[model samples]
Target: MSPTIRSLVIPVTDLAAAKAVYTALLGAPHTDESYYVGYNVDGFEVSLNPSGDTAGPVAFADVDDLDAARESLLAAGATEQSAPRKVAPEARVCVLADGDGNPIGLRGR
Candidate 1:
């Protein structure tokens, strides 16, 4: 926790082509799917998603309490771009936007 960015999701247009490039750079992915390709590098997650809103990669800050952390961001004038959604068992992620429209990703339970 401690506001660390341990997860980052990169948006790619071509899944297969991106996979090949990422695999060459980061080795093989641990989780591969039609929509997602995830690589684990010493506990840091580097994932690829073709459906991300931004053209650039999104770095997700790992938080201890998702609801509280999200609320705090909203209270500080951040806009909620995406609601809390579960990605896995006890794992959830959401997208928020700052005043300048920069996407802020949060991932945790």
Candidate 2:
């Protein structure tokens, strides 16, 4: 199964400041912010995670089969940051680092 990027959780230190910037950039306030600030713009869902020292960009993708996706990524030379683990009752997530230490999170049920 191929993976499709479903959402991106950008780590931002300043929630208020970043919200304002994103609001201007997206032309509206985030659609959802109570649980986690999320802005749906141009067919992309940008989620703002209120923690982390994210120095750069990160990508999160959704896969139909998490095990297969993880295997493919490993075969493609990605290094595991975290093995697949259930974060919810019916879902699992994993993370890997690419050649340049860029993180990519994988999610599936």
Maximum-TM-score candidate:
1
Tens-place lDDT per residue, model 2, 1-109, is 5678877777787778877887778766455564357778777778776664355445778888889888998999999987888856987977888898889899897
The true-versus-predicted C-alpha distance at residue 32 of model 2, in Å, is 4.1
List candidate 1 stretches off by more than 4 Å.
Answer: none
After TM-score superposition, the amount by which residue 33's alpha carbon in candidate 1 deviates from its true location, in angstroms, is: 1.1
- Give the whole-model CA lDDT for all candidates, comma-separated: 0.91, 0.77
* Model 1 error, position 65 (Å): 0.9
Looking at model 1, residue 108 earns an lDDT score of 85
